[model samples]
Target: MEKRVVVTGIGAVSPVGNDVDAMWESVRAGKHGIAQITRFDLEGQKVTLAAEVKDFDFGDRRAAKRLDIADQYALVAAREAMADSGIVSGENVDPNRFGVYGGTGIGGLATLESEVSKCVKKNTPARASALLVPMMMPNAIAGNISMEFKAKGASFGIVSACAAGTHNIGEAYRNIKHGYNDVVIAGGAESVLAPISFSGFANMTAMNPTTDPDRASIPFDVDRNGFILGEGAGWLILEELEHAKARGAEILAEVVGYGATSDAYHITAPDPEGEGASRALEMAIEDAGIAPSDVDYINAHGTGTPYNDAFETIAIKKVFGDDTKVPVSSTKSMTGHLLGAAGGLEAVICVKALIEGFIPPTAGLQKQDPELDLDYVPIQGREADLKYVLSNSLGFGGHNAALIMKKYED
Candidate 1:
């Protein structure tokens, strides 16, 4: 028999707010978190802004010193989620059945960049630290998280660029639904605000060129340009429904469906017709046994880039129809693009939206693009009795993933 999966706990370290409650509050008020870059000096940089996690404290200096910034963010968010779920590995749940599935787009870029720079500048290969491999590997996030929680079951990292987080959650959901695991810690983390990353993105014209924070990440707007890089982590504690109920856990929302597809057409740009994305959305709704019209809200993958927004609109129209009234919006307008962590954070937002019955708006989206017509819930959020929310995530290398979260009921 197929088991049901529910999200019992969520945690976030985002640009808008460090914790889930604070982040949701800021998102509800349609607040943008974009600002000038502070992680490094931008004296000679074209892109001068990013959505950085301000005033972050790891709370463990000794442990923080041994991990990369991305790992630190994951650990902190995981700690919060573990505590929120109140599931001790050995006491409430079987440590052997618990699992961790984490992801990152650019794993430990800061550590890798720093070590390589040191080696080149000193003209000695031995300048690299012995802990470089363990700290910088992409799987380190999952490994560290598993060790932290003593999860002995399936543990690994997925690196599908920006869709990595959603992939992580989707994989975890399936694992639990298939009865392979009773509990899973799943999400994504990213902290690559280093010099090399900035230069590469800027040169590729992926980062927003505008310096104004207000207009930096204006998704679906006619004036939209590109996305602002953001860093942080978002995590969810997913547990089997029966297992959760048996342990008296509070179920926040249920993971009803997940759909993932590959464009196979382009490496960076989405299919011009949005065939892949539309298929993913359709597959998700179908997987949930719900029609497209049944989706109460849609958390769009509106990266504010010209190609992404336009193509995503095409995909939504293809699946939901042209005159669809679904309240669609992009939280990226406020949180900026967390890249690999975008889906995880957006998943957290979707679960919260289902729980709170509030629809967040695409902040800073004033003039809508006439070409792309949809109710983007612009400028400000409003109250709504949301039943099911769908979150879309499109990544480079033509990856598209969609997740459906339904309101919990007895």
Candidate 2:
């Protein structure tokens, strides 16, 4: 028998704000977080704007120093989520049955860059730090989170480029739904706001080179060129439905469906036909056993890149019909592109929209591309009775993932 999974708690550390409430408030107001680079000097960098987390403090100096920046973000968000869920290991839930499924696009890149620079500049390969391997490993975030929370059931990180976060949540949902785990902490974190990261993205023309925060990440707009790099973390506590009810947990939403597919065509560019993405959306809708019309809202994976935005439109149309009336918007316009954390942050937005009966707009989306026609809810959010919402995430390396979240009703 397949069990049901529900999201009982959520947390976020984003550019718009440090915590979930602050981030959601800024999102609802359609305010952006992108700005000029501040983590490092941009004297000769082509890309000047990034969605960097501001005023972040992990509150524990010793612990913060031990973990990489990515791990720190994950730990902070996980702490909030664990507190919000009120689930104590060995008390309400078994520590052995608690799992941690985290994801990251480029984990601990800051540590990697730092260590590599030390070795290269000092003209000696032995100049690297002794703790470099553990700090910079891609799975370190998951390992750190699992150890912190004593989640011994399943602890691992999924690396699917930008789709990593959504994949983590999806896998966690499955882990609980199949009776493998009672509770799971699923999310993603990223903080590679270093100069090398920026240079690579800028050289590839993957990032918007603009300095204006408002216009840097304008999704679905005709003038949108590319995405701005954003760094932060978002987390959710997914529990077995029965376990949540037994503990009197406050359920925010239900994880009804998950769909994952690969483009198999390009490393960075999406398939022009959007066939793979379309199939993923179709699979998710079918998995939920719901009609396309049942979804009240869609949090699009509109990355603001010309190919991504246009092709995503086609994928949505493929699943929801050409004239579908479902309200669609890209919160990335405000949050920038969180890479692996994008799906996590967007999933948080979907849950909040479902709870508050509101739809956040695509900030700075003043004009929509005439070719792509849909109710984008541009510039300002509006109230809506949202029941079911879909969050889409399409990453580099042909990764495509979709999650269907239904508002909880007992």
Candidate 3:
């Protein structure tokens, strides 16, 4: 028999707000987090806007001078998530039964850039700042999170570019389900609003040209140019079913199934037909032991890119086929695209959907593209009774991940 995995808590330091309540309010109210670049100067970049985390102070979690922003963000969000799980002190919480798994697509880019500049001007590397490996390495999210909560069961990172968050959660779900650990801190964090990061994405033409935050990230819309780069950290606590019951933990949502696949075709683009993604979705449904018709809501990885929207729509249609049982909405339309943190943040949205039983609308969706014919809860958010929510995320480098979150009944 396999152990069941359930989400006990969620925390997010997103572009819009600091914690889950504020962030979800911003998302539910259709507040756009994208704005003119303020983290650094983006005067000449074609894309001068991003969905950046605002008003985030690392606080007592760590001294500002001691850690990189990426790791700080992870710790801050992890603090909230651990508290939400009702196990913050980590005392009496079995250290040997807890673990950490986190990721960041572009970890601590700002720190790396500053170090490089110092070396070039001074003709010698900064020995004091030499821990740049741990600062900028993608695994730093996991390392920092482990230190914050002293999770000692197991720890690692999943670097799947943009799909990192979802990948981390799915793999963490496996860790708990297979009895590798009873609890896992899983998610992704990112802080890549640097000159090189922005220019590299812009040069590839994968960024939204719209300067208006209100309309910048409109996935599946006819007028969408591309994704508006976004940044944040989202963390969730995945506790084993038996453990959660014993601890009297509040079950946010049950992670029923997780499916992942590789496009094997492109490092930057998905297959035109979305065949790889389509298969992943099907596998997820099967793993959940649910028919396609059982899924009620789909939180799509709609990145507002022409190819991503069209391809994702085709993939959704493939999973549901003629049934069309699920209503799809892309919260990225409001949060912009969080890259490595996309899946983690989206997973929080799904869990919230199951908790609140309301599906958030896809903001900025004024006119739909004919290519995306499925019913998108567009324009305004909706209040609905949700039973199961399938969250999907496809990353660059041909990585695709799907997770099914269902209302916990038992």
On a 0 to 100 scale, what is the lDDT of residue 349 in model 1?
94
How do the predictions measure up, each by TM-score? Answer: 0.99, 0.99, 0.97
**Model 3 lDDT on a 0 to 1 scale:** 0.87
Give the better candidate number (2 or 3) by TM-score. 2
What TM-score does candidate 3 reach?
A: 0.97
| Candidate 3: tens digits of C-alpha lDDT, residues 236-269 | 8999998899889999999999999999989899
lDDT values for all models: 0.93, 0.91, 0.87
Global CA lDDT computed for model 2:
0.91
Show model 3 residue runs off by greater than 4 Å. 88-90, 126-128, 322-325
How many residue pairs collide in each prediction? 0, 0, 0
lDDT of 3 at 15: 86
Worst 10-residue stretch by lDDT in candidate 3? 125-134
**TM-score computed on alpha carbons, candidate 1:** 0.99
